[model samples]
Target chain A: MCELLGMSANVPTDICFSFTGLMQRGGNTGPHRDGWGITFYEGKGFRNFKDPNPSCDSKIAELVQNYPIKSCAVISHIRQANRGAVNLENTHPFTRELWGRYWTFAHNGQLCDYQDLVTGRHRPVGQTDSELSFCWLLKQMEDKYPQPPQDMASVFKFIAQCCDKLREKGVFNMLLSDGEYVMTYCTNHLYWITRRAPFGKASLIDEDVEINFQEETTPNDVVSVIATQPLTDNEEWHRMKPGEFGLFHCGELADGNADQLIDVPFAEKKVKCQAPTEPLE
Target chain B: MCELLGMSANVPTDICFSFTGLMQRGGNTGPHRDGWGITFYEGKGFRNFKDPNPSCDSKIAELVQNYPIKSCAVISHIRQANRGAVNLENTHPFTRELWGRYWTFAHNGQLCDYQDLVTGRHRPVGQTDSELSFCWLLKQMEDKYPQPPQDMASVFKFIAQCCDKLREKGVFNMLLSDGEYVMTYCTNHLYWITRRAPFGKASLIDEDVEINFQEETTPNDVVSVIATQPLTDNEEWHRMKPGEFGLFHCGELADGNADQLIDVPFAEKKVKCQAPTEPLE
Candidate 1:
């Protein structure tokens, strides 16, 4: 129902190239034209630019394309307006403060009964199912760990489990970040590509633009980008299978289960039991 | 230590004229060159533009001046960085969501021993006395009323009382909004001016800018602007008292006690009990 674009980098890197390709889809190359938003994290600090206007013609989007805002982690979204009206409040990516750190989220699917999810301390400022689920996930995490989790593995696993539960309702592709790490859950279409040493040229699929990574970075630089669709046609993009979850930190896969495609029977059974007669969009 | 600018309008009006004057003080005309931020509320939706650079020369600030982002309520700040480092995280105005509404705040004064205030569900993402006080105030409000208050008068009074308590720590001049109303509390220098049917030419104090409101606004339009100092030299601005708190809604003074200069004895006693040897900045 929407589109997502995310990035994690070992060094502060700008998403201007990938963002250009993505903006073309916001009413130009594709159908997602309601609104668009993007967040860039620089160390523990972050800022977001959101607009209810279509990104294709937005002055702010133009500024973002021209301005090189370097960040370690970035999340972006273009909405199709499935659950909320086209307004600034309902624009993705939604952000909240948890554990004294800013957490950003962007969803790319529709949930049939997401309103059933109970939100505790964190509440959605906008009337969007995406924001509702984000709040619910954060509330669940806070409930489980009153403070920051002792181990990062447990936190990643818990987030994956929550994604599995959310996938049972409907499609649940998402991108989440807390400045340091990026967690992506794929219930449908999602792809990622990492650029490291020995990088080469890549051409955008949506636009007639090309960039040589060799000229853009040093050999030590590492950058990873995740998107609903691959932005570059020539690059080798890794497509994630449905129900797969991956965690990236400092531009590299950090989760032990990053490549694993384990099927959770509990989630499958719940989905089978609550399957709607009407097909999901 | 900083400067604040706020606007409350009956109609969705652009504050570009006033903002141009204020941005001049962010480096060109004054010493508040650390950072600047501005928030504009359109109905229940709002967006902010912030930069950890001098507003006088910031490209984003230039865009803000050129583009007209109309809103009914706005809060802005230019920081001199008294209690925190100069970074994006420490930029104002800070924002948080409570009771499904976005609340924005910007402070122009320092508070000693402000970290003692207990924060509840809300937490500050940035390490600043301004954000800490904001979170504490919101936490107090939530503790008293879990849901939206039935009577706005009580909420306004409670907020004023909280401001009174915070003023005991030191100078606590602040501007706050919950999308619907703009609340201004002055512990030192703060000024306001209202423009309605009888509009005339006004000249900026910090910049050579002049505008005839007769050509820009309608006769029925009611708008109010609040700032740490008078933005325009030609306009008659009302200077508030040290202990005064005023609430503006729909571009007009809505709080019954907006003009009352009441001194809470409890706050006075606390200030007397913890009076430091050095005068507050």
Candidate 2:
């Protein structure tokens, strides 16, 4: 399976610390060595850096880790190719423009029988099942709302429904963002941690690096990071159950109807569906 | 005004040498210090690196210069920010998906009264005259052909007509590519040079660097470089006239109708129209 890493923040912040831990898993600590990509959303604008090479040996990935590009939303992926060839086109963290906003998506799990999913104006440039799924989701959203909806909760609800359908195909843990809001849907493995005031020290699980969150933030700053696996061992990450969905805005779980939105339960936790595409298996 | 650079090659060629010279003009050698961006196409897939920071001092730009990412088509820009703010959103080389291909564009001149150019499905995420023109162009193309046209020459003709209309508003030197063909339109300043066998040494105008093409390229390789100005001082560059459009494919001016497609002049060469937004004036 590929790994996904995302961040949503109240203010523009950099993901250098968390990314440093995840880069090790791209090759050194784990087996997702096909390719890796990351997208940084600076308000309505964003930039993506992708390398067909393994992250552990990528100069572009190293530049990204060193450059503290402050952004409110970020999506990153390290891929282990299954359905697509190991090429630059098959790299993860694909983005397409919708409703005058660039929507970015990265998928962690594989999907089976996804070729039947019809897409509209948004089409996949790459051959990955992940990209096909993202295009299909965007088509569904665009079909529902010709423009951005007046009520965004309906948007989140619709996304949950679409993801629930996709989960039925196979593992479909995904992280999607449209510059302002980050929506996460979990089918198998996903975890998130929100750090605010009264933050303490944290140590990376994959690397021998420690960081003090207190020194890196203001008292009012709130930042949430979602990943396939917990990057920091000391932090209390909320392990998402299968079929759980989350909508994060300004670094916190969005307040209104979040309780209802968080627990959809389309599939039971640890349910083994019929799919040989699962990379972990 | 801004500086535009593009490359089209028969083989997957790296633009490190030319980009190194262009990076110097971002802040050190010229005045386009607002921001910079570049897109490299690998088949139908592309990766974009943009920075609101000046390219001369940008670490990302440094990484790009050092990393020889090979691509057959590349579009890059350095902006001085006349019509928009100096932010990441307004950076040049804006991209949108059309006909399932990522269409990359970079404009070097300003447009006057461009808000009336209505766009359809494709919309501009960034607030810039350049992006507005790109979106408008895509909308026009989409309206003309729901699918990719069987006769690409007709598509080029339509693009030339649209560019002629855009040039009527103001200076609109642009470089656009759909990962296959590099289309160039000039109103003020644009130049191109193609190199193949019997290549010699070339010296950069902006940087103290020289490269021997004999060592870097094979005999079968045909590479073309297009820029707002001639990057290499020693090479003879073809200066495109006002209202001229050229379509390049596989590093050569596409034959069969290239002579008929090369020149479609609608404006005078030295005619200075009314664009109060001109930065170089």
Which tens-of-lDDT digit does each residue in B1-281 have in candidate 1? 99999998877788999999999999899999999999998668788898888999888899889888878889999999999787778999988888888899999999998989998767777789999999999988998899876555567678888999999999999999987789999999899998998889999999999999999888977889999999999889999998788887768766436433233222222211111122101
Lowest summed lDDT across 10 adjacent residues in model 1 chain A is found at A272-281
Alpha-carbon lDDT of model 1: 0.84
Q: Write the per-residue lDDT of candidate 2 for residues B19-67, one digit (tens) a residue.
A: 9999998889999889999998886888898887799988789888987
- Cα RMSD (angstroms) for every candidate in the order listed: 10.5, 9.5
**Docking quality category of candidate 2 according to DockQ thresholds:** acceptable
* Stretches of model 2 off by over 4 angstroms after superposition: A255-281, B255-281
Put down candidate 1 lDDT per residue, A1-281, tens digits, no spaces.
Answer: 88999998877788999999999999899888899999988656777888877889888999999888888889999989999888888999998888888899999999988889999878898888899999999988899888866555567678888889999999999999988778999998999999999999999999999999999888987899999999999989999989988887778766436433233322222111111122111
TM-score, cand. 2: 0.91
TM-score of chain A of 2: 0.90
The 10 consecutive residues of candidate 2 chain A with the worst lDDT sum are: A272-281
Badly placed stretches (over 4 Å) of model 1 are A256-281, B256-281
